[model samples]
Target: MSLEFELCLRRPFTLLAHEALLNIYYSASCLKKKAGEFLRPFGLTDVQFNLMMLLKYQSEQDEGLSQARLSSMMLVNRANITSLIDRMEKADLAIRTPAPADRRSNIVKLTGRGKELLAQIEPLYTKEVKRIMAALKLNEQKTVIEMLERIRGNVSEINENTTQDVSLVRA
Candidate 1:
């Protein structure tokens, strides 16, 4: 369905650029909602699933990841990551231990239960993702990926420009 129709807009968008941005936002929100519903039965949130996947696929063998590292990788604040880890700990899905090199920083690792749950969920998750993306052909999907990358680059550039403008104003 067209974004305008889906949004029930009485009139056309004022700007094509704004329309495109809203389309992206709406699509992302819808996807997140669906994913949350899909994951809820498994007793996991989307963020937790993402964190578990990272730990499963990216962590060094038996070494785990530091909380700071997880925060940066997850694009979240340290406090948020800490809270997430705390919840996961309570659920026995993950554990935090003192980092070997830096006792002050905790290393987060998936527990055995966590690994087992992920192993069970990953295949179903992959299938759901495939079903979602199957609407777009492989080439179309590739193009979408490229376009989104460009959008991200543009956003970064704009952010830098805005920061510089703010600093100049202050100066």
Candidate 2:
């Protein structure tokens, strides 16, 4: 059954745009739910895993990311980052060290354990994404990506006057 069929709407949508919007929203909700379930076995939430991924890349430079920078990168506020960093530090997945030059600031770094977790889960995550995209042909995937970018641009343009870029939207 198609997404529309699965949705069991009271009546057919009058506009293609309306149906398409609902389809995208439903698809994203379904994908996020499945992904969350998949991550459960690994003891990492999606956000924590994303944070680890950021640290993994940054660690290559031998420089830790400051807490403020990480907050921006994660698109999380300071309060949430404090709790997230606390949990990750407790799990030994990451470490926060005081920046030498700035006593009040801390830098976040992935520990050996964090790298190991990413190594273990990366392949499965890759396979899962490939599996999901396999529902569409290569060209269809590319077309969808282009269409989504345009839709995103249209949406972002409306909020240009806001101080924050809409692109930094949290998951």
Candidate 3:
């Protein structure tokens, strides 16, 4: 069924671009909710699962990623990392240790339990991802990626300009 029909819209979108944006947002929300339901049985949220997987692969270096680096890599606020890490640590999925080079900074490490859980979840996750991706042909996937990148680039540029204007107003 069309998103317009599903949403029960009385009027048609005036512009294709408007409809596309709304469709992308609506689909992403639904996908996230479904994924959350899938993850809940393992006692982990989607974000926690993602972080564990990242650490499992990225832990080539001793002690894995520093809190600052993890925050930057995950595009999350540094202030939130402490609480997230704390929960993971409590669950015995991860640990934070003092950085070898930087005394003030703490590095994150995945625990054995985290690795085991990730290994269990990865197959199901990969299958789900592939199932969703199979909806589009390979060429269509590439085109979608390109279009999304262009949208992000244009929006980022406009956001940066708006920030500059706000700074100028403040100054």
- lDDT by residue for model 1 over 58-154, one digit each (tens)? 8989578999999999999989999999999999999999988989999999999999999999999999999999999999999999999999999
Strongest candidate by TM-score: 1
Model 1 misplaced regions, further than 4 Å = none
What lDDT tens digits, residue by residue, belong to model 2 across residues 33-134?
A: 888998999998989988988887765574878999889998899999999999999999989999999979999998889888999999999999899899
Model 2 C-alpha lDDT versus the unseen true structure: 0.88
Root-mean-square deviation (CA) per prediction:
0.9, 5.3, 1.5
lDDT of each: 0.95, 0.88, 0.89
Task: State residue 89's C-alpha deviation in candidate 3, in Å.
Answer: 0.6
Pairs of residues at least 3 apart in sequence or in different chains that clash in candidate 1: none
Alpha carbon lDDT at 163, candidate 1: 100
Q: What are the runs in model 3 whose C-alpha is more than 4 Å off?
A: none
**Judged by lDDT against the true structure, how good is candidate 1?**
0.95
- Residue 166 in model 3: lDDT: 100
